[model samples]
Target: MRYASITERLASLGSEKWAVHVEARRRKGQGEPIIELTIGEPDLPPHQSLLEEATRAMHAGRYRYSNGRGEPPVVEALVRKYARRRPDVTSANVLCFPGTQTALFAVMLGLVEKGDAVLVGDPLYATYEGVIRATGAEQVTVPLRPEHGFHMQADDLERSITPQSRVLLLNTPHNPTGAVLTADEIAAIGEVCRRHDLWIVCDEVYEELVFSGSFASPFDDPELAERTIVCSSISKSHAAPGFRSGWAIGPAEFASRLLAVSETMLFGVQPFIADMTAYALDNPIDTSARMRQSYKSRADQVIAGLADAPGLTPVAPEAGMFIVVDVSATGMDGEAFAWALLDEEQVAVMPGSAFGSGGDDFIRISLTVPDEMIDEACRRVSALAMRSGVRKELRA
Candidate 1:
């Protein structure tokens, strides 16, 4: 029997990238003392006020279906939050979804399709390729070199554009690498997009997770507002990933046009969740601030622990909860080293190859674990790297 082309396009795009993570989970289920650090789940809980708000709304009968656009209160809250970033932002500019993932899917569908090209950075978030491929668009990967701090270079973006290019998918406080783009960097990339008439779809899910840099986005620039759409959620900012509350801020017309696509899949997010999301945006909380401190400290711990280890160099993240370590000098690629570390040291980490070729020599470590756990994990990783380095030297 034949299947839709989308099925073929997305065949290995999902859980396949998470092979190491899946293996680690299986081992842990069997009672292995695994220091799991593969995914980016927050170690913190949702703010108490946000939780209470959801419960209150649910008890008040907010379980019913919502409109295609979003719950009114949620839209209003989002407007006020974003209006500070771009003063002209209004309810019309917002479209709520279950999370940044869904918002991105809807936005991509509205912007590109078969025969078009979507320019995205290499070493992008694991799900980005699947999202773009699902739309039948060709994904043109622009190399994000580590030497440049993994931030997407405007020159590289411009070099990758072709006549078929329709959009530039960007992520700040970037996943895997945690590289945040500066205001000047954003303006440069925006200029490239403007020159080519490409839409900029930025995944700002980690917007509030910055540790060492100021955050900026194309959406914040008035000249780029019409072409920029920002997708974000309370997942990281409020420590509420399970709530599945997120939205897209874009040109009103784009949001209006995408409403049909969003409705076709999921008409709206849960009303109770919407209420909680609204509360999250309207009230400034310390959740993100706390996370910023914890994640940064944990990352520093790992980097410091590995400082004396042979052949392992942990890259400092400017933002976000994950840090990458270059393990190429140990005479093994990231996948091999990751499995070896799990088997020998009982530590689980995602191989850089899971992201893309750009990350082939690296392994990503999540900073969501406690300090003690991070310390132990760091020690284990350092030990493994030391052993691997010795083995390489002996072979030489």
Candidate 2:
């Protein structure tokens, strides 16, 4: 039997056990207890106001088709929502999507041409490189190392830029590294991007999830404003990932073209969710402080529990719901440690390699799990590492 080839188009494909583990547990058909430190999903429910508003809209029979570009009132609300920092921003700057993931891909589709290259931070969100790859563009990298607090530096970026490079994809409160760019870091990046004439697509999905450090967007600089495209979602901030509502804020023309490309690509996000999403922006959810504090506590505990574990060093994070543990000292690479722990102790976590090249020696721990699960997962990881003589010696 002849079949179409999926190989060429999806060349960069690799297995990520996080989603696999999630489904595997569900298929057990009953009480299989799996400690999931894999996915970034929050255990918290959606905001009370958002839930009530969505329910009312659903009951009112607002299920009819919405404008493919997005409903006007929601777009207007989004304009006002972001106007504080971007005081000049109007509805022209906003384009809504079902999820930031889709908006991200749309930005590439609208901007990237075949054979063009995108510069991405190494050890970025696992899906970023995949998105850039799907656009028939090559994804280049500038390493974000622990010695540099995992922050991406302008010098490294300048060195990596090539003639084919057309875009730089950045994430703050970075997914695997949790390195939030400071205001100064933002400026350095902006200077380079402008000098190189590169399009800047900055993802601020964890904008409000910062703990030790503050966040500053590339769009904060007026000079970089025209070149910057900002992507964010209500999923992380509002603890409503299921809603799949995300948006892009950029120059009006690009926003409109992006809306056209995206709506044509996926018909714009679900209209119901889009409506409730707008209502969310208008009503606002104040879960920032609580989320930050709880994630910080969980991050602290993850490190403390692994204190006596061999070859493990905690990379202190400034923001975001995840912290990467340097498993280099454990004499085990990330994949080896991750799979061994999962097999031996039933604790599931993502191998750093799942993100990009610089992640080979690390593993990411999610703060979305309950406190007891956090304790248990960390304990199991530490116990496995204890079998190493170095861990025993360090304990003594």
Candidate 3:
């Protein structure tokens, strides 16, 4: 028997959180229920209108291959929705894909050639490096310091750009860190990218999840808008991860190239799914105010809980459904601490080191669970610290 050699590019990338979750599930079998706070999966149900729209589309026999670019109605609806937020983009600039992950992959594949370099934030979405690796592009990470609230420094990003650098991946209200970029930060990044003549790929999946202030996108600037590809999805906003619907909005030229790549990669997104997503976008099930309130409540609970725990101090999350808790005061590496908590208390959380080097002494917890679960998980985690004699190290 012969097997093809696995690509060298994927050799160094491994998701510790996923591996541990899978192993834990395998050991528990089907009987024991694991309280999952590791992955960023929303527990809420998707919009009922989305389900109704899907059912209607199925009844109407609309489950065929869609236009490679996406169904016209769906694209038009996306254009209108985005126009309300970003007036510069039109329907012609949008290309629908199965999900934001796929859209990201398509954009990277279309723009990055072999040996090209791309800049990313440290402790970023773990998959960014993997996607860049798959394209044979080198990933240079710019550190987002905890002291600075995980904000990306424009100077650091600019310094990382070399002649081979072609792309800058920016995730605002960033994953793991939950730090939203300020308007000034966005403008600085825009200026740097413009000066470097680098394309900006802004991942704004958590745009609507912001708690304290307005979400700023690099696309807000006319100069940056032309060079920016905004990739987003309904997974975070509408709790519709299973729907697998997302879009990439950019210049018409870039959209055309991305459409070509998406068509060849996945043929076309399911027409019924596209239609359902369009319907949901048109009539949001939960008002944005209600959703934001719920998330804010959860964020507050998690932050307060962490504050009470010994040797654990979590930065207040500005947006998104995650909080990164610093565990350096406990004098233990994040991976070891995460596994110890899981084994001793049966609470599952992602080790921050899985994200990047900047996350080495922290752990990331998702706020997707209920209030009671969040309380219980925090109690269990705090118990571990008390047992280890680290409870006195917490800062007052």
> What lDDT score belongs to each candidate, Candidate 1 first?
0.93, 0.82, 0.82
Q: For candidate 1, give the lDDT.
A: 0.93
Q: How does model 1 score by TM-score?
A: 0.99
Worst 10 residues of 1 by lDDT: 208-217
- State in Å the error of residue 260, model 3: 1.8
Question: Which residue runs of candidate 3 sit more than 4 Å off their true CA positions?
Answer: 1-6, 12-17, 27-30, 390-396
lDDT by residue for model 1 over 1-396, one digit each (tens)?
989999999999999999989999999999999999999999999988998999999999999999999999999999999999999999999999999999998899999999999999989889999999999999999999989999899999989999999999999979999999999999999999999999999999999889875789899899998999999999999999988999999999998899999999998889999999999998879999999999999888988999998999899999999999999999999999999999999999999988888889999999999999998998899889889978998999
Q: Summarize candidate 3's per-residue lDDT along 121-217 as a digit string, tens digits.
A: 9988878888887888888888898888999988888878888899999999799888999999989988999888989999998888898768888
Against the hidden true structure, what lDDT does model 3 obtain? 0.82
State TM-scores per candidate.
0.99, 0.93, 0.94
Residue 283 lDDT, candidate 2, scale 0-100: 71
- For 1-396, candidate 2 gives per-residue lDDT tens digits of 754443455555534435445543563345556677887888788878888877887787767776656777678888887787778898889888878998898898898967899999998898887678778888899999789999999999999999999999999879998898989988998899999899999999998898865568988778888899999998888899988888889998888777778767776556567667878777747776678899999999988888877778988778888989988777778888887777777777888888887999999988998899899988898887876546547766
Candidate 2 clash pair list: 98-244, 311-329, 311-330
